[model samples]
Target: MRSAPFLGLSVAATLSGCAVPEARLRAGLIDAGLPQPIAACMADRMVDRLSLAQLMRIADLPKATASESVPQFLRRVRALGDLEILGVATSSAAACA
Candidate 1:
């Protein structure tokens, strides 16, 4: 019985640690030059679907060039119709425009 409780606590702790804060994600998006509405929508949509690992990858994306804006990067990704991985849809892109 003690082991079961400890296991449950471990799982809860792991899951809590993996959660990406919505505000942080939103701020990251905005800092990357995405308009506020788009940033807000993307953060809200992604927080539920993306793992902490995925969010970290996005946050670490290289901003080496001015042309390589977040919206541009996302547009390229969306062009491949892979928004499901990002937890968004093409319709969400429309809202950003």
Candidate 2:
């Protein structure tokens, strides 16, 4: 229906204002215990691939006090129970490493 298409456009417009910056995403990743280089690589890839809502969601995940290993980070993400987020993070970690 015409209403469905219009609703989609409206939602897109609203989310456009919520776009997460690459630098912020990278910083968040680093805060989450990833190394700087890996965080930067993953942030670039994820910002391109994930939606705004997903990005915002991940931003609120637990941050580590110290740098964490890849396996440790993945395990923490997996614990949160969002498969798509986990998948993107895992693949990005693999690709960036």
Candidate 3:
């Protein structure tokens, strides 16, 4: 039996959506302890390959949403205010999901 070489490509393409540019953000979010599910949603949301600058932009975003006792970095993320952090969270979710 023969299989389509690209059969696996669809998933690769789907994840390729933003796999590279979003690497840093993903790492950061993982470190931040953001729940896995929400993080996956954000990473899957990104479609285009980002420039290093754009990746930095995503990396620059915050992680922690609210509730002080959570963590300092999370609070910093909330204070800074950047939705891209969701990408980070999303990536983590992808890992566990």
Candidate 4:
């Protein structure tokens, strides 16, 4: 006896946390020592729903293990390789923007 709409809403809420808001993502980057402007760049790209790998690359995140959580992924992105451009992803993700 679960309603379909309720299930849908539940899914959306769960996914929203995984997706996160652009502002929060930016703040995380700055707190992690990444430049603040990159947040805007990443948010601009996010206008399109990017793949998980694409987001990781744009944010300069590392590959995660089975034990990793969504926040863990964000943390890795914040590390950001100490570079503004993150060195073009070195074959990770696609060239497509």
Candidate 5:
């Protein structure tokens, strides 16, 4: 997948607060076939504010099943409350954009 490289070193860097550039992260997510709005939302996050597990989940979003739309997947994720703990304001779909 296009995000393979991002999954390895970049995610680690992100968790450490020395994240890869936001543009690169967003492009990687886009290249992985994630919807632009979802990618934008995830890319805008402050990596330092998220836990390693949270970062990993975000990176893995591209692997979501074809049966799921981005909004549906995001809604499920939001329901988990992980994003809330990370301070990601996910009260509306617009927040994701």
Candidate 6:
């Protein structure tokens, strides 16, 4: 019975970790010139679909300049050569836009 309480706490901690990455991703998307709504939506989708390693790879991508468009941002993502990441990013952008 004591283990059950520990399990609950662990579950909470795991779930909390997920939020940090999602919020950071949303901010990154906004910085890349996507509107806030689109950024939020796409971040949610990408966070749910991609693994932590894929997300970290995305986080490592060069920051988007102020003049960059969404398509331009996607081109950089495509260059990563991870088809799953590219697909999630493209589909998320399409759905969010």
Top model number, lDDT:
6
List model 2 lDDT by residue over 1-97, tens digit each: 7699999999998777445466677877888999999988988888877777677666666789888998898898788788998899899999998
Higher lDDT: candidate 1 or 5? 1
Clashes of 1: 0
Per-residue lDDT of candidate 4, residues 1-97 (tens digit): 5699899999999777665555454454445444445444545455245444554454444323344333443446446553433333221112321
What candidate 4 gets wrong by more than 4 Å, as runs, is 1-5, 21-38, 41-44, 47-49, 61-97
Residues 1-97 of candidate 6: C-alpha lDDT, one tens digit per residue: 8899999999999999999889888887777667788889989999999998888777667766675666987998899999999999999989988
Candidate 3 structure quality by residue, lDDT tens digits, 9-94: 87788777556656665555444555444444444444244345544654655444542222444345545455555444344335
Task: Please say which candidate is ahead in TM-score: 1 or 4.
Answer: 1
Worst 10 residues of 1 by lDDT: 60-69
What ranking emerges by TM-score with the best candidate at the front? 6, 2, 1, 5, 3, 4
What stretches of model 1 exceed 4 Å from their correct place? 1-20, 62-71, 75-97
Q: Give per-model TM-scores.
A: 0.51, 0.74, 0.37, 0.33, 0.43, 0.84
**Which stretch of 10 consecutive residues in model 6 shows the poorest summed lDDT?**
60-69
In model 2, pairs of residues that clash are none
Estimate the overall C-alpha local distance difference test score of candidate 5: 0.56
Estimate, for each residue in 1-97, the C-alpha lDDT of model 5 and write its tens digit: 9889878887787565644555555564565456887777766763445555665555554544444455665565565567553345243234565
Superposed Cα RMSD, model 2? 5.7
The per-model lDDT (C-alpha) reads 0.61, 0.82, 0.49, 0.46, 0.56, 0.86
Cα error of candidate 6 at position 37, Å: 1.6
Clashing pairs in 3: 39-89, 39-90, 40-90, 64-74
| Candidate 3 weakest ten by summed lDDT | 66-75
Better structure of 1 and 3 per TM-score: 1
Off by over 4 Å in 5: 1-17, 21-33, 46-48, 65-68, 78-93
Instruction: Give the per-residue Cα lDDT of candidate 1 at 81.
Output: 43
Model with the higher lDDT, candidate 3 or 4: 3
